[model samples]
Target: MGSVIEREHSATGSMALGQWAVIGMCMLFNMINGLDTLATAFVLSSLSAEWALNGFQQGILLSASLIGMASGSTFAAPMADRHGRRPLLLASLLLSGTTMLLSFWAQGPWSLALLRALTGIGVGATLVGANVLTYEHASLRRRGLAISLQSVAFALGVSLGGLLAHALNETVGWRYVFLAGGSFTLAAGLTGALWLRESFEFLAVKSLPAQQADHRPALSNVATNSPVPSLASQRLFGRGYRQHFSTRQWRETISLATAFFLVMFCFYFVVSWTPTLLVQTGASETHGIKGGMLLNTGGMLGALLLGLGANRYGSRQLLLGFLLLNAVLMTLMVPATQVLSLAIGMGFTLGLLLNGAIAGLYILAPQIYGTGERASGVGLVLGLGRLGSILSPVVAGVLLDAHWSSQALFTFYASSLLLAALAIAWGRGGTEERAGRSRN
Candidate 1:
């Protein structure tokens, strides 16, 4: 009896520690991902001057990383479902870090784009892998908060990157920024390899029924001895793509992807060009960096607030409200950009609402697919969604070259946000809350 009680206590301790470990480590990974991914944006001003780049060329440079991100999300992220999240995450981190370091040596636009693209792929894969890992570990009731924390960490990293560039670019030049970011990322990869563990759900799914039966006697002493209930009984990917999901599932997935695409399009446009746009409006390079930092700082706060309220108020309702607010903010940003103070304030607000709404979408994502296909499902959506990111910068470049005002561009994107909210409203509701309640 004493031994049984000890075993039960050990099991409980392991379970609690495992959850914390996954969340804490994944959050760290996401922070690094954000820092490395946004480093280029932070340094783009210096790079543009150095290369004597045209507007179209600048847009291409910004879009190159995003294009790589799209490919990584579609192809590399899904590998987590088969190989396990930890391994894929480590590999991506290493790849990203290596490429970022290599980018420091880039002599021209072509070489720089190539390196940035490779780094983006790594960052993209890491993003998807970390999300899936965190979601699987978090209880349903706290999933929103957990994912929000990840977003908060990411935003914090972006803010830090901007600040670092602002402080160091003049003193050290842009090359050192990549050097620092790459070194930190490689360190993060090592930390993950040492400390991270495979998702329990993935482990259970991989364990054979016969093997489980053989282990039952050993696990029976614990009060909660059963394996985590599998979200789907179907084989991973099944016989074919069509056989894996029903028509309803497909529709829901497509709707989520559409919403993701639209929001990301708007988000990346602001992120990629806000600094340059600020410069065009007569702000110093320092002020431009400050503007970017303010946007991310607001994003962190917005994500925290949304996470706290989402469970109580309902994810869908919060999402809609946030998106609506984002549209209003984006429209207002037109006139706000004319004044330095106003632009800073508006940029923060825009980041808060826009990023907060996106966080809500991340909370809703894992609910749409079963465990068997969750990684692939999320990856595919994010990958396809990156198309919007890839195009937004290039499109914005063309328009800017044609002498389009920032006011007109933001207003157009604001309309797109409304359309995205409508698309999300038309989709299926999340089952995660219900699942969490049932499990409790």
Candidate 2:
């Protein structure tokens, strides 16, 4: 009996060893996910010209995608909680990739917008599933590091998309970009279908004792602190649990949501209008695209460095520090333009910090909730954040239409970063310890 137990432990250890490999594979999926999310930004100008779109139309397109993304976030979290993580993720990847591939065939702006919105749904769902998978598999000490690595993967994808678009858009055409980007998602989906395993925790929940007489599983494997109420019994607002968004939880959620709004607002604005900004500053479309690529590269580097810092200082300090740096870099966007290298360098710095801060939010959010409520909490926060994403492009369009100077654009972005800094400060308290306890 003792030897049998020892053997089981050995097998568990071996299984864990394979998790690192799985994590690496998941990173590829993360990259593909980022590509799908940001590809629209790269092609916005081309689409505007080809379709003869106005600022309002652009805003509508951006908002449409964001609304779909929010729908995914709102639904997928509960699904992941009730179902399992791996299955939902696999489905998300396939659906998202297929939708993006279909976008290439759209005949008009409305069709393209619909397809893009569907793609956003896939992207949004996949983001939550992937983050949960990676974070849950990680040790408490390394949780922040794991999340940071995912951010790096995302930044790398977006950066590469920018660079690739700059180099190939003239030769291959914009539709090809969509096709190529979509292909990555297809590859990731196939890989996941072939290699991904159900999470052990999720499996343990499902494998709970069966009813011998009925020959069926007795209870659902989904985690929850409260009793499993019927669909009609479940209530989000009523006194369902001991703590329904206590003061601390509400503050944490609000702070994170606000930070997400500001960061996303700036991020989408840059993604949608970088090319236009470059042109306004007297650069070619190619130069503008390259600058976008440079910014992403900077972001990737920042995520890598911040991942290391997360292991040392915890995600909280790292987030605050990064937010401050991002504010400074964003404010300097106009002045740094005189020297192209300075502009690129500054953009890179901003990207790094931006990616890290956002990643910090993902890492810390799960720590704040119990196992049962985790998915719902994460879902709600991300859903609200999508509202920010929805607003960002619209705001950018309005500013562009107002004939705002390039300097004014940078200045506006700077204010968002400053607000993020404040939110980060407000959210401080017990996050690292909470994360550690969740792992135990």
TM-scores, all models, native as reference = 0.84, 0.81
Model 1 agreement with the true structure over 37-139: per-residue lDDT tens digits: 7787778899999989887677677777888888888888877877888898999999999998998899998898899899999988998898888877765
Clashing residue pairs found in predicted model 2: 299-351, 299-352
Q: Model 2, stretches more than 4 Å misplaced? A: 1-15, 44-55, 162-173, 204-248, 272-279, 282-286, 400-405, 428-431, 434-440
Q: What's model 2's TM-score? A: 0.81
In candidate 2, where is summed lDDT lowest over 10 consecutive residues?
A: 217-226
Cα lDDT of model 2 by residue, 1-440, tens digit = 13424323432233355556557766887888777876776787888898899976776665666787787876765576567778888888888899888978877778878888888888888777777777655555565677678888887777677667656567877787888878889889899898887555444434544332123211221221112322222224233333425664777777877887788877777655655666667777778867777667767777777777776777778888888877777777777777767766676677677877788777777655433354556777787788887888667667879998878887888789789879878874334544444666
How many residue pairs clash (N, CA or C atoms closer than 3 angstroms) in each of the candidate models, in the order given?
0, 2
lDDT of 1 at 31: 85
Q: Pick the candidate with the highest TM-score.
A: 1
